[model samples]
Target: MTDGIESLLPPAVAIILALITRRVLVPLSIGILVGAATLASQESSGPLSVLTGTASRFIQTIDQSVRDWDHLHVLAFTLLLGAMVGVLESSGSMARMISGWTRRVSTRRGGQSLIGFTGLLIFFDDYANTLLVGGTMRTTADRYGISRAKLAYLVDSTAAPVAGLTLVSTWVATELSYLQEGLADAGIEATNMTFSVFLQSLPYRFYPLLALWFVFVIATSGRDFGPMWAEENAAAQKPRSHHKQSPAGSWADIFAAVMPVGICLIVISGVLVTTGLQEPAESEMSRWQYFGHVIGSGNSYLALVAGGGAGLIAAGTLAIALSGVSWELVIMGSAKGMLQMLPAMAVLWLAWALSSLTGEDQLNTGGYLASILNERLPVEWLPTCVFLLAAFIAFATGTSWGTMAILTPLAVALSINLQQSLLASETLLAASDMGLSGGSPSGTAASLAMSPICLATFSSVLAGAIFGDHCSPLSDTTVLSSRACDCNHVLHVRTQMPYALVVGVTCILFGTLPASWGVSPWISLLISAAVLWVIVRMLGKHPQSAST
Candidate 1:
């Protein structure tokens, strides 16, 4: 009944089935059913009841997800955003906007670079970044011979890494929440102190930083290898007939697209700061800390829902007033857009359901992985080990947030234990006694000092989880990126994996491993960048060259 091999079966089944079938929904459903059966078998139930129990489990998962306010808000945001995209497409605003931009983006490299830049600007949330970038750029990318698989890659690579690294983002709040719990259990209970630790750990976050740089490298250099190279070459050989004549759109078309996005940003930011200040402050703080705390404590999900609704309305109103589209057409466009999202939304729902089953209350998949760190190890090896472990768990579970929830506390506790053991060595004690005028500091003092290994381990968990998320087909961001580009999900995964694996391997060798041994993360980062540049230049080829 305890967390064990059973916890691994469901995700394993889901991933394998998804790959073998090249489809998501049925595989995800079967995996959930397997998970439910696993849970039910633990109870003393009859065969008939067990079958019925599996159905009950499926229904309950959806019921719980829908009833939760945050989940409901996410669903609302997705639907509204989908409707907005529909309106833009139906009214011809989207096409016209892309046509205007195409003159500036005269080459494939420029188009890819623009997409990457837009992704960086929308750092408030990953979902928003993925959806907005893909929808806005898909046509231009095609005109420039950029493959759908490549477009999906550009959108996905930027979405999570940018959001995760930014100071004020939906990911920051989640990261801070888990870090607070981890620090509290590790005997650093100050609520304000977690923000400081979070900031301190930023420099050591090598994977996200390195992953981002790799995106621009591929964009600017026009160099690619692996499955992506073949995709790009194939796309380049196609007819250049995608947007032969730019639509007769004016400034109104551009405004119809840009205004809604601008409004969405304003509304999300305003609501975040407003809701963050709702409760009275209990302590005085500096302006910087106050701002950081506000962002970390804000109701981001609510902000997202409000922004989505406002954006949808703005797009629809513009389409009707300026685009000369009939109201009926606008309604139909909205309906069509929302309907398109239904399949992706269903996959998202099933993904969330599977994630829930791996929680502490069910199969305890994360718990089982967390238990592995309890074994003692040399303090220097902690970061590398934690990085590998976090990567594996996130790949298996398909959720970075869940991996953080499971590993943060356990990794922090383990780091402290290993540090304590190292400090208690007879040689270390004698050296401390001889070097200092007084005896060693108290245990509390030693434990409170954040060591290099602690910082590396903290960063490792974050970066490794993202690395896994990039490669996992079950990841919601991956699914959204593919859907937004209208790319085949299986093709997206196949093409993206080689790039992710390259960066991931490089991250471990130059980043996590070196930092664990007290090397400067800046140096490690520089080395990693240099190495990647060499790899891309030496091995990569231009799609144009390949096709020629």
Candidate 2:
């Protein structure tokens, strides 16, 4: 359906029902059916025709999604990672690591902070961060009586923002390309200024920076609010007798945990490097640029799959070698972990199916949004509005890359027009005031504000995409965060929503709005932080039973 409002329905329905039902699968399935039905109704108005169209379209969607190599690749990667986690758990690697950590970091706050900080430190790749940090830290969190949902939150909260901020991340290349394209489209000659521009945007990256601060504040303050508080409180009161390991299992070898993860990283790096390896032409200048090009263009999904497979093999071998676990048991545990992923996989499939409905061949949701907003959107307000739009689109489609790819050019073009319009308006005003019919210094000043405004919107698009992906149930990182932390997917979504929203709202209101209105980014950060503090203080309370 090319209908703009209709395009929003499926994801909106799914999100609402998910919140109300506290379950993702049924809602997602219904959403998929509804979307297909919508598509069918577009073909013919009859209810019977719609039913027929939905069945055919739904089957086609599922089959096409499953058969797509990219989809299969991601599915394989996710399931293998789950198997890897299962192997780690059975080998007592997690238990031993957690037991020692528990002894040293005795308090729940310390434990939570450790997990949060670890996620921040593992910033090179979000997938690596989510699976490695969340997977390993879950037991430690449980030992300290932290809720699984809270652990998932900490894991997810740090993954995207940290990865987005880091220079050498998988995200960097993609982000740079989009920005370069936008700048070029805006007639800004940014030749070889990629790194410089990114560095400048660093200060303006209020959402991610503030999000990191939000996590730290919660951890250090030992306070929580919103739905998260209730869960944290209940988790604290629950006895951890089941989490405690016997003295025998305490001797589980560190190598059992370390080796598999090491191999995973090595394999992923090796694959990306090997596959993306290419010689630069004699015309090329910098090695750094060439290497960046290599990394930026690499197939991250393939690399992840390579890592997952290697990890599965290494983990199984290690468990058999060090933990004295039987090969059969290791295999069985791995199988069980793969099976545990079935529910998330089902949800993921439906999410993917829903996304396809708005693609090039289907209804063009992004283009529709652009068309509708083009007439109504003002130039000065472009940054804030663009940020909000990117967030909603990313949340709805559950695809940050898709959202950015669609919106970056549009945002950049809009910003340029807005700036030009402002310059023209200022010139007219200056001429009218001085009784002179020519351009003035005010126009030049307004023209200068153009690039900054564009940059701010670029930052917003990036920030909003990350935030939307952060809280989306259809997001792979969100799903993996729950899988890694062993929390219910919907429950994790519920508990984590408030924290994400606070950072997001603050970034939009205090950061984007003021930054566009001649306000400095540093001031925006201060205001955003102040807002977060006020909200958290007024609403967030220390969960009563949290372990000291």
Reference-based lDDT, each prediction: 0.75, 0.72
TM-score of predicted model 1?
Answer: 0.64
Error of 2 at 336 (Å): 21
Tens digits of lDDT, candidate 1, 1-548:
44787877776677677546656677777887888889877773799888888888878976674575555666677677778767777888755665455567678889888888777866756776787778778787778889999999999999999988985455665565556545544455555455556766887888889989999999989988999999999888887546664554589888886787678778878887897787455498888877876764566667777887888899889988888989999899889878876765666566566666755556766446545544455667888887887777677767676566556655664565456445545445676678953344345512443567878888888888898889988888899999999999999999998898889999989988888888898999999999999999998999864222
Give candidate 1 misplaced runs (Cα > 4 Å).
1-24, 27-35, 38-62, 105-212, 218-249, 282-284, 376-501, 512-527, 534-548
Scored against the true structure, residue 539 in model 2 reaches a CA lDDT of: 84
- In model 2, what are the clashing residue pairs, if there are any? none
TM-score of 2: 0.61
Best by lDDT: 1
Clash number for each model: 0, 0
